[model samples]
Target: MEFRDLNISESIMERLDEKGFTEATQIQEKAIPIVLDTELDVVGQAQTGTGKTLAFGIPIIQKIQEKIEENGRKNKKAVKAIILTPTRELALQVHDEIDSVNKGNKLRLCTVYGGQSIEKQINKLRNGVDIVIGTPGRVIDHLGRRTLKLNEIDFLVLDEADEMLNLGFIDDVEEIMSKCKEDCRKLLFSATLPKSIMELVELHMGEYETIRVKSKALTTELTEQIYYEVKEHDKFELLRRIIDKEPGFYGLVFCKTKADVDQLMRRLNDENYSSEALHGDMNQKQRELALSRFKSHKIDIMIATDVAARGIDINELTHVINYDIPQNPEAYVHRIGRTGRAGNKGTAITFVEPREFRRFKYIMKISKSDAKKEKIPDVTEIVELTKTNIIGKLKQLIQTENSEDSEDLENYEFENLEIVDELIELADSKVIIDKLISQLFKEELNRKSYGRIGDYGSRKGNDGRDSRRDGRNDRDRRDGRRNDRDRNDRNDRNDRDRRDNRRRNNDGGSRLFVALGSMDNMDTRRLLRKVLEKSDVSKDNISEVNVYRNFSFISADEKTAKQIVDSFRSERRNGKPLIEYAKR
Candidate 1:
């Protein structure tokens, strides 16, 4: 049924329409009605992207009729609803969905998750919020700090319950739930109702309604899942070819580490692919900017590590490519779940090194995806793919460009035909394409004389040799190394420090525009001392502290700025702190 049928606000319905959501998925269809009817507990069994968020969110938003009060004003700062997810990513996703649905409504949403300053979250709480969506750890942290008051919570939601269990967050989830009022409305969503989840339901829920919607079952008809075994070294080149050949497809490439994400991003950029990176190391603002660009279709691919991609929900994901196989089956599910959402057709491809074949099989078995194998594309195939991609892009360019003028049309026609002819001659047909692909594969094989994918040092259980090399050299110097080596160590440290200092002090931490009142009542020295005491900053880290008539700014390293943001998040600082990465 339509979102409007759920009796949600008109603005929310409009948002759903804009997001291209019309009919409710099975989970939403069943759970929304039950949730809207009463404050009774709900237990929904469904995988990710089964419209679970809207299922509970619509009811939570509709039913929570609490009066919000803030700062001697009759306003509601006490949250009417709380949603807990296992990861910061999932938490943010749920929060964004709820926010989209509650657009134009008087709901003040806040998210609490790790990999961020808890003090910052506490400050958000102090600013007042009506709904709290967070990870279990951060939520519990807030509870301990007395920043998150759940006693007044009317609705409590446990999303991705199985993930929470798998992540060992069940205990933290229970603790956070215990802080909620006894009569609070409770709802839980999970892919499977394992024994642990059932136990949680039994212990916490009251007169709950149950709804089950199997994601794999629903998606099997519309989606394709496949894996290709390639050498680890060849994955990047393979991904580039696939991206070139896949017409009209927007994709995500998941990497295992932030460094991988950055490396892949740079590679894609250098190769002229419209791409961006997302990782936990990036701040919330950076993550938001990247996501925004991606959603706006400014970027074709997002190279991300899982940690940084928590809480991201993009409905139009056509493909999910595992550049590196996920560490766990659950992660495999999560990564692929980004696609095949809302009853849409999607594809998930995993690149498995020969050594990782067994791990891939295990993941397939655990996830129970209807996965099949794909042969590695040979060199001729890669060349043909590159040609095909160029042709496709040319066609698109011509299609969108204004061709009103005869001369423009003639130029486009000639240019298109020329490109097409060149591509056709390069690899005439599928047979020739395969031949070219094979030839390129052979060339690659010959060039990689040092190692093959399966025989790479990565598969030999060697880790972090790169990180240890510098230390080894340093130790050698301390043990009476040659004069040259000693000189190198001194220069290396200076260079390293210079680079580190540049990254932190891009704009030279000068002044902070603090948002506080009554400068005369504020002591600059005392505030600086307090900031230092509350944060992880050392005295030597700060160069100076400047206080103006209305605000205070600090000069320090980027690390020190982060420390201040973390420490003084809950403290009453006079004015807004300019605690951000300074620009060059």
Candidate 2:
């Protein structure tokens, strides 16, 4: 349905046209008329990228405008509505979106959130605003101080209600809703409605219409799902290979944690990749700057955690790389959904470690992800692709330079041509051409780490079989245990590292033993890496790792080996250490 056909005013319709909001999305088409004509509360269920804000905002704006028209300027200046979001970034996003529809003249909005001055927000509320967009915690602070009043608010919107629920904002949300006028038209919009959301609807909403926009699936068909079987340590190396394979790679990469997001982002930036990081630790301004850079194509990659990525507004993206596999199937879908949007084809790639393959299998079963197993492209292949791209750009430039109709021609080309004529006289054409092409090839492919990824050949975990005699319990246990361990490790990282690498010798000559070898798919290199991940055991400590069918032997200090064994004890099956112990 079209926006013009809706009962919205001509001026608003004109504004929509100017902003290119021509057709109503499925949710908007179904919910707009209901909202515009009724005073009843509403529950709109739709995905994040769907136009949920516009659906409710259009009617809310018109209704607020209507109330103002009837009640005089007093209604215009009063706070008539409040929209609550889960995060500060999301609050700002909702505010900007609604303000765009309102044109900021008829309606005033104050967005309050943490990390900003509470005094500033209080003053804005004191000055009387028509609408408030804020996160739950900040909004509650205002409510407690009585600086913001919602008693007269005619509309209360809980956007991203599920996200709020996940963030433990139910009580705060309920309190905020209770403060609104008894007859206020409440609206709850969420991608997924948990039990708590429905409970809120039943408790606070009367005669509310539940408008669900049915999903074709959690993931779209436009996305091609592929997984590369790579070791954990080589994940970054494989990522760079993927980037090199595609000369114009532009995408969002999802990491499991904020630290991971920062770590990957720093590495990418260090390697001269145009990249930015978005996560919870950054203040609103920094997040906005990173987002702005990504949107404007100043950066080609945005490395972000799942929560911080919620506020992303990009419609077209080329790829979504799961640098660390998400434990939740829905999360995997959510991450991939960021790409292959606006009807454009996108690629979603997962770098699955051997240890993670079992969990990946379970996620696939639950989410119905049809991710194909793909081998990471070899270094030679990436180099060849890079060379081809360089030559392709060179050919394109030559074509543009030679064409009379080409307006993109640089004036510098003429000057370069004069120099080229002189060079042609001074040297053989073949030599000059060879050197030029060679220089371009070297410059493009000179990345030192480009060819360093190991070939973890043809490990297909695509059969949905448990890689490690894994069951549902084991899967659940692994997820929960890993999460707990990672959180604990982050808290006392230095202490934990020291503990993991207990008695280290200056010479690094001690040897240790580990159980479960080739049969468990554990090789010398992989076993050594596993030790290093959990311990401060340097590579020098483990000079040679010898693997047998059912056990392995490695080098480590006597106490360091004991500590490594204790560290992985939780991973033990049949009451063995996670990494079995042996005295040298």
* Number of the top-ranking candidate, with lDDT as the measure: 2
Would you estimate the TM-scores of all the predictions? 0.53, 0.53
Which segments of model 1 are wrong by more than 4 Å? 65-75, 214-224, 227-266, 272-320, 323-347, 351-367, 370-584
Worst 10 residues of 1 by lDDT: 444-453
Point out where model 2 deviates above 4 Å: 75-77, 226-240, 247-345, 349-440, 443-584
Candidate 2 has its poorest 10 consecutive residues by lDDT at: 477-486
Candidate 1 structure quality by residue, lDDT tens digits, 242-322: 775575769899997789899888766644579999987888799899999999999989999875666679888899999
Q: Can you give the lDDT of residue 469 in candidate 2?
A: 48
Residue 348 displacement in candidate 2 (angstroms): 3.6
Q: Residue 364 CA error for candidate 1 (Å)?
A: 5.3
Q: For each candidate, C-alpha RMSD in Å?
A: 18.2, 14.7
- Local distance difference test, candidate 1: 0.68
